[model samples]
Target: MNIISENKSKKIEIEENKSKILDIKKEIEEKKIKIEDKKKELSKVKDMAKGEKEKMEEYKELKKQFKKIENEIYSTIAPLKREMRKLEKIVTDKKLKKQIQEYIEFPVKTFLNDSDLNVFRESIPNIEKIEKNPRKREKILRLIEYVLDGNLEDKKKEYMAYKEKVDSFVITSREENKEGIIKRKIDNLQSEIIKSEEKIKNLETKNDLLQKEILKSEEDIIEILEKDLDVKVQE
Candidate 1:
């Protein structure tokens, strides 16, 4: 073929490769959407299962109890952490300042880890000396008193008890119930998702190959324009 005709053919080849890549990408997106739909169907199936559904309700109740205690503890400690952040700026003692830093950074963990408010008790005298705002200092003292009074410790114990009960609870799925009778539905959806994923993978591999072909065609086009026609290609 003449150089001009050869160049035209290479340009067409690049466009064809790009068109094939776009088609493959469209197919991949469709497969992904199908996989998501299958997963949603699977979730609906599990929710319909009578035996597992009742069991999930029990598990949800236990979690509800645990969350109530968890919220109470954090709600009480949240203000303390804010107060500690204020103190962190003005505290003079290195050890007290660092402890306050830890409290501000990880309020729940530090508060639970410190037994009997030992760090606060040790720094109380220092805090009183440096705190300039009477209202803030009073609020800090009251919060410290709350921590030392064993109320938080009692709640902590309760939290741990509920936590263990929640964690130790088990969830098992059975296929024999009236709702669970269509376990095959779940199996079929899972199979569909797997097949859709495999198709996407194959499409991706094909697209990558097409990309290499497009690059080769473009390179050939550039060479023909620059060398055969003695043309100045912009790119």
Candidate 2:
């Protein structure tokens, strides 16, 4: 009787549900407000994230150039893999076979690390013994001899040239990015953005269910009051 507003009750059957306050109607409204506020916060965070990424333009460009130079180095050393694969199968020496395998696996790194083609020089005699597929063996041996003769030394020099670019890019990137402070900030913001977006999606999903449940609750209350009490209910 105290909750009655004329003929209407001001309070419902329950003030809360479960361990947490679950005022259904109020919860839906509060979540709607939070969704909007979060959207605005996300927009600002996105803008800040954009600004942080812009600051790393130099580093990004360096990365682009680094990939380009790496591809060039890869292209330069690519043929060695095919030559080594055939020769590795034909060569009998265990040590030389492994050395050939290294070049096949990390062609560019192995080539650059060889130093004046000493790896090829050491393996030359072993490779010379390869005579299984006479034609194929001749071809593979030709490649090893080419490296020993310093004809392929230019490729190593070429790799070193790209290495210089990488070294310079690293030094400049560290100095400009200032130990990656901007990159770290950008990464953190990206992580926050993902979390915030997920939170908004979850809240929206909950709000949708809450809104429907509230409507259904209202319908059930009206039906019960009208059928059981034999009275019209209006609020």
Candidate 3:
């Protein structure tokens, strides 16, 4: 009876172990699927990036599409990570944490999930302590706010600087374009002047020919008159 009871207990323990293993496997598969989905989302973003054009109409449309896909990827990954954290919390398995670390510490798109995840994981031990300590939370929150506000201010300045530089570049380009147009106009005017000079030369030649013909006709009339006079004298 003792032997049978021992065997039954071992079997139950094995079954429990199997169940836990299956659960872990399922979770891992789900994570892999999510990773695959993220890869696909990245691919779509790349495709959208390739679709840009120099024309404002096509470029604006592509820009909008790219922004949409980028936002979707970011939003999906953030929530997926939060979900993963919740799942990790439920599993008591140590290997599960390692897997979570593997996924989170990866060079993914999220700031929270990248190199920072390990830091967050390290802070997991202090989570309960920090929660219990209100002052700690307040301190952390203040620090975060300060950092974020400073970053935003820096970004604003940088953006303004960039905008100014771009505006200057545009103005310079416009000036160059204007100069090019003026140069073309000047060249065209010079060509027109040459054509006009040629036309004037042609008109002068025509005038000289007309004048010579008139002189020749006058001489011929005078000769005819002299011949008539000579014939009368002879008679």
The number of the candidate with the highest TM-score is: 1
lDDT of 1: 0.77
Residues 51-119, model 2: lDDT tens digits: 656645655765666567557656655655765675677767797787778888887677767765545
What residue runs in model 3 are displaced by over 4 Å at the alpha carbon? Answer: 1-176
Model 1: how large is the Cα RMSD against the reference? 20.6
Per-residue alpha-carbon lDDT of model 3 for 76-173, expressed as tens digits? 33433543454456556686566655545441233322433333343345444434467765654453344344433443344345445555545654
- Higher-lDDT candidate of 2 and 3: 2
Show pairs that collide, candidate 1. none
TM-score of 1: 0.46
Q: In angstroms, how far off is 108's CA in candidate 2?
A: 0.7
- What's every prediction's RMSD, in angstroms? 20.6, 12.7, 43.4
lDDT of each: 0.77, 0.59, 0.49
- Candidate 2, superposed: residue stretches over 4 Å from native: 1-77, 80-97, 116-119, 122-131, 174-235
Per candidate, the number of residue pairs that clash is: 0, 0, 0
- Residue 140, model 2, lDDT: 63
